[model samples]
Target: MRRVVQFSTGNVGRHSLAAIIGRPDLELVGVHAASDNKVGRDAAELCGLSEPTGVIATDDIDALIALQPDCVVYTALGETRPMEVIEEMAKLLAAGINVVGTSMVWLVTPRQADDWLRAPLEEACAAGNASLYVNGIDPGYSSDSAVFSALSLVTRARSVTVQEIFDYGNYDDYEYTGTAMGFGNSPDDPLPIAFQLGVITSVFGGLVRNIAAQLDVELDEVRERYEPWYTPERIECKMMTVEPGGLAAVRFAAEGVRSGEPVITVEHVNRLTSAAAPDWQVPPEGQLGVHKVIVEGEPRVEVNTLLSHPVLDVTEAGCLSTAARAVNAIDWVCRAPAGLIAADDIPPTEMIRGLMW
Candidate 1:
């Protein structure tokens, strides 16, 4: 069994705790919580596990590093404090501990990350002989990696498009839903993400670049597009309310074009409600969301990955899937070569730990 620890108790990290405890192949060693308030809490209680695992959550970075565990499943909030995440990741990597999770989506492809940011991690891997792998729902198995695997079926390929179409209403985080994504704001209101539109070239654009790299396609440049729709009527969610005429639906795409033609694309269709945009590609009845990869090529293949849960809604299930993505990659990442790694390099598994939810 691989000895492992978790970072943060957020949605992703909480689900990861359940996964790590339930898996017989993994041993829970420690957990890194965000604050002193969470310190000394049983890891099981933190994530609502049925039994205690003896491991406790702490905010002590030096103490956790002293243990020299195999890897740290980093699920902390990177957007809020990116520099802190990078610095901590560097600390862990330099301590000779492998790292994995959803902190930086752009790091999935090293080239997509800024040279200065990427340099320290590469140096850490070399110094400690440890590895780092980044994976999650949108930037993970559900996107570029999925598209890459489908290419093997085609004898000759033309173009590839990967999309994430989901209802954001299921997610109840007030800050994320309202502020970050521009939900419940007027159409003209500035969106945190839209203002940093060039940032797409690093996140989703990394997925596009990964696809192009594997297919051996030369993309002259990657482009970004953002389109939002306003709600025709007032809508209510668990966290916030969207008045009529407020932003309701958003379609963002990062395209990898070769010779003026889009050959690889990563797009997202997010909505507060299914009715927010009747004309757009909405979910089917009772379905939470759809992640698809369409290949406009010789075989013309397409993959629709639809996730639904009996207890949790779509967004929660997306969290579960993202957690699963990181948890499942733990073992593979530990055994992979040292340095920053890509999700595509990890082996694919159809069913992991029976997928509790």
Candidate 2:
């Protein structure tokens, strides 16, 4: 079993912890916790496992690196503190620990990442001879790999469009749902999601560039757009509450232009509830969320993935799937050559899914 450690037990990170324990080939060796409440707790206790693994959670970075784990599932938050995450990733990689997680979106395409950050990562990987791969459900298998796989079945590919339609009312975090996404703020409040156009461009831009590389086409520019919806009335869920005339839906889109024509695109239609943006894309019946990929080419092919389980709702299934994407690929990433890797470099899905939960 490959020695593995869970880094930060938050939304998706907690799922990574479960996935690490579920896999027969992976041995849970350590748990990294940032919250004071989580520190000093048993790994199993944090994850609600049947028995303790004799491993305790710690906030000491030195201690984690000293473990010399084969792989670290670094699922700590990076959206608001991206630089810190990147710096920590470099440290882990340089210490010879292969890393995988859903940290930064630019990591989806390492080549086009910011020079200052990407250069350090490259240096660290080269020094320690370790590898890193980062991805999530939407920017990951649900979109990039799925859309690219569809393109293989066609003769001539034209354009690609991937979409995620979700309702965040069931999401656990209120800060993210209310403030970061503008779920409870007034419709007129300036959304942080809208102001980060450059960041969005870099993240989805990588997906577009990867597609262009596969088709041997040059991309001219990448673009991002955001549009939000106003709540028609008061709404409440298990997580947060939205008042009338407050922000309810946020629609964001990114495009890759080639020869003045858009070739690759990713869109997210997020809602607080089904009634929030009825006109916006909604998943099929019985599904909490859906990821749709449409390739407009010869015999346009479209693929729709419904992320919902018998017990778990769409958000839960989606989060688990995202965690599984990186956790399942742990062995593949660890055994691969040292350096930044992408979906194209990964082995087949059947080979990567060594042990399913």
Candidate 3:
């Protein structure tokens, strides 16, 4: 059995903790808590488990390294703090601990990452002979694994598009939804970080490039486009409130352009509610979210991936899937070579470990 340490107890981290404890092939060793309130708390309490695993959350990285687990499931936020997250993972890699994480979405296609961001981790992995694999739902499997798999069904391929359509009403992080995403802000105001220059490309562009590489196509450029929707009435989400005329929905797309056409595209449709954007894509059957891959060619292929949980809500289940995405890859990453790894690096398999009951 592989011993594991879970890092963070935030939206995604809590689920990672629970997943580690529940997996029979994995042993819950320690948890790295980021907040003072979470430190010293039982791992079970942090993840809503009834029984304690005899593991407590700690803030010390050194302490977690001392435990020397086979792998660390890291779910800390890396969108805003890329450098710090890189350094943190570098430290873990240098300590000889393998890591599978959902943070640092740009690292999903490690080769596309800027040299400065990729170099440190590579050096650390070589130094300790460890591997680092980063993945999540959208940037993780939706665009890379799911897209390529669907293409195999088609006799001839033309162009491919991967989309993430979600209602953000259940996403409770106000700082992210309200401010960083500009959800409750006026459309006339300056665009938020979500649409700022190079942000979408930095996060999702790698998927486009990775797809191009997979198909042996060269992209002349990658272009980005953003569209915003204003709420016709007040809509109150769990985290923030959207007034009339405030930004309610956003559609962002990044396309890999060849001579004159887009060969690969990654798109995101995020809304505060399904009613926010009647013209744009919304979740199917009024559900919370769905990841879609559309391949336009001789034999058209459209695959939709919906994730739901019995006890958790849509947003929580989404976070759970993000955690599961990394946790499922633990065994594969443990045996991989020492370096940054991507979805294409490992063989494509379902890797579902949960019991049917």
TM-score leader: 3
Ranking by TM-score: 3, 2, 1
> Per-residue CA lDDT of candidate 2, range 149-222, in tens?
78877788888888888788788777654566767778566656634657567667677777677778878888
Candidate 1 residues 15-49, lDDT tens each?
A: 88888888888888989997877789999998887
Ranking by lDDT: 3, 2, 1
Please identify model 2 stretches exceeding 4 Å from their true place: 349-353
lDDT against the true structure, per candidate, is: 0.81, 0.82, 0.88
TM-score of each: 0.93, 0.94, 0.97
Cα error of candidate 2 at position 239, Å: 3.4
Model 3 TM-score, all chains together: 0.97
How many collisions between residues are there in candidate 2? 0
For 132-186, candidate 3 gives per-residue lDDT tens digits of: 9998888888987889889999988889999999888878898755688898888
What would you estimate as the lDDT of candidate 3? 0.88
Ten-residue stretch with the least lDDT total in model 3: 348-357
Looking at model 1, the pairs that clash are none
